[model samples]
Target: MAAYQDTFTSIPLSELATLAQSKKDEGARFINIHAATVADGFVLTYTFTSNETVTDNCQVHVTADDVVPAISPLFLAAFVFENEVHDLFGINIEGIAVDFKGDFYQISIETPMAVPTKPEHATAVNTKYGATVPVKQRKGEEQ
Candidate 1:
């Protein structure tokens, strides 16, 4: 087994772009980006490898209404993951080199991976992003 160290740093959305650029300049390769929908909102994780041995995770906590800055300006490959995250999690991502506008997968539901709620209360609970219709009902029933 290999010994590895992981560093996780929390950053504000405002400084995401700047810090990401700095990491690129330091010879870090963008590995992946992911998000998890929590009770309060979302926790975005940006993974990078400075080398084969060192990995860094830039974690950003955001509310349902927060808009995260895109890191494509520094790491172009990030756009792909960012688009997927946007579509699945519905976390707003601003300023990517290639923006998908939340249509990355063409699924019937928007933000399919978002935290789930009962279909009946989805309209009221998810007022910020519209209602969450059940997948089965999405085809023939009204939203």
Candidate 2:
């Protein structure tokens, strides 16, 4: 078996479409695009695979106001991931082959994965039972 090799490269947002086109010309399959919220903005990762063992990723960092170009023109299936990232992370992706216009998901919360700028929404606490449970009922506090 060939050793699996994965590589990540950071690129400017403007070059995303070019990178995708280059990868397609190289006979690589578009794997997927992933988005994550960062302290100041968001990071988008575009992944591609070749030879079933080699994976290449292109990462871009953009602020909420940055407009990202869609790669769906090169990879038709990229529309799904682009719409998802736009709907969930609120990234402005333009020129999607199949634009969903934010209707891709029937979610009530807009940009739920976006970074919270308000102080109230910045803190999160998770309890085993629930936040409503009295402190005395916790496992360590149980008598």
Candidate 3:
């Protein structure tokens, strides 16, 4: 048993991507990257694991501005992880699928979107984006 453990570190997404590229250039594969946001900042995890065991690992937690925009068009899973981060932590990611709020949630009491009805994003984040059905004005001489 060891009394010390490896620590997590946070770096910008752009930097992380560059590092990944460099690693690939050096013939490393089987990489995984995950990002998380916390009360004080965010977390970025990078790993090159094989045989279901982590041999090379790195984790970084950083302040809001310290993150890198996940270049998700390269990796499909990055897109999903980013969505979960934005939905739960409000961390903004550029070029995200929709870059809005409110997913397929039930709008229940436990949901964060209804907290104050943010007149701006409430409409776009829903899975039903731009899905307004026609409604008619009724009961007037002008109608």
Candidate 4:
């Protein structure tokens, strides 16, 4: 909580935790967890509406489609973040943590995350320039 309160850039949460511990060991009065929160499909933010000479608009946000994974030996808060990911994105972290059956996406045996995007030229209408692309690299890679 405290870290999120202070963090500007997104550090891997475990790294943040380690850094927090080092600061505490150096006799820090208190430690802050700079992790951030999100809501309404956007990562919660701390931002400046007006422009400044130098300060960037500070924000740390995570969306359901995006996730940062934990680092290891063991990060106590990592699982919690994983849970958050699952709660929001329907992912399973605990199972992955233990090398059990797990998938971030609800992948079925027949359709396991092989989704591909349509080619850019496939949908473009630049026939005046050319047929959007050379014929050699078209679908089926036909030359």
Best candidate per lDDT, number?
Answer: 1
Q: What is the lDDT of residue 98 in candidate 4?
A: 34
In order of appearance, the predictions have TM-scores of 0.79, 0.78, 0.47, 0.26
Give the number of the best model, judged by TM-score.
1
Error of 3 at 60 (Å): 3.0
Candidate 4: lDDT of 50? 18
Score candidate 4 by lDDT: 0.33
* Model 3 weakest 10-residue run by lDDT: 110-119
Residue 114 CA displacement from its true place in model 4, Å: 26
lDDT by residue (tens digit), candidate 4, 1-143 = 11223334443323533643453355333311122322222332222211222222233344324443432124333344444444433332333243323333344432111111234423322221123333344467544
The model with the greater lDDT, 3 or 4, is 3
What order do candidates take by TM-score, descending?
1, 2, 3, 4
Query: For each predicted model, how many residue pairs clash, with residues at least 3 apart or on different chains?
Result: 0, 0, 6, 7
Alpha-carbon RMSD to native, per candidate: 6.4, 7.6, 13.7, 14.3
lDDT of 1 by residue, 17-67 (tens): 788878888888999899976666778999998876767898898877888
Candidate structures ordered by lDDT, highest first: 1, 2, 3, 4
C-alpha lDDT score of every prediction, in listed order = 0.80, 0.78, 0.49, 0.33
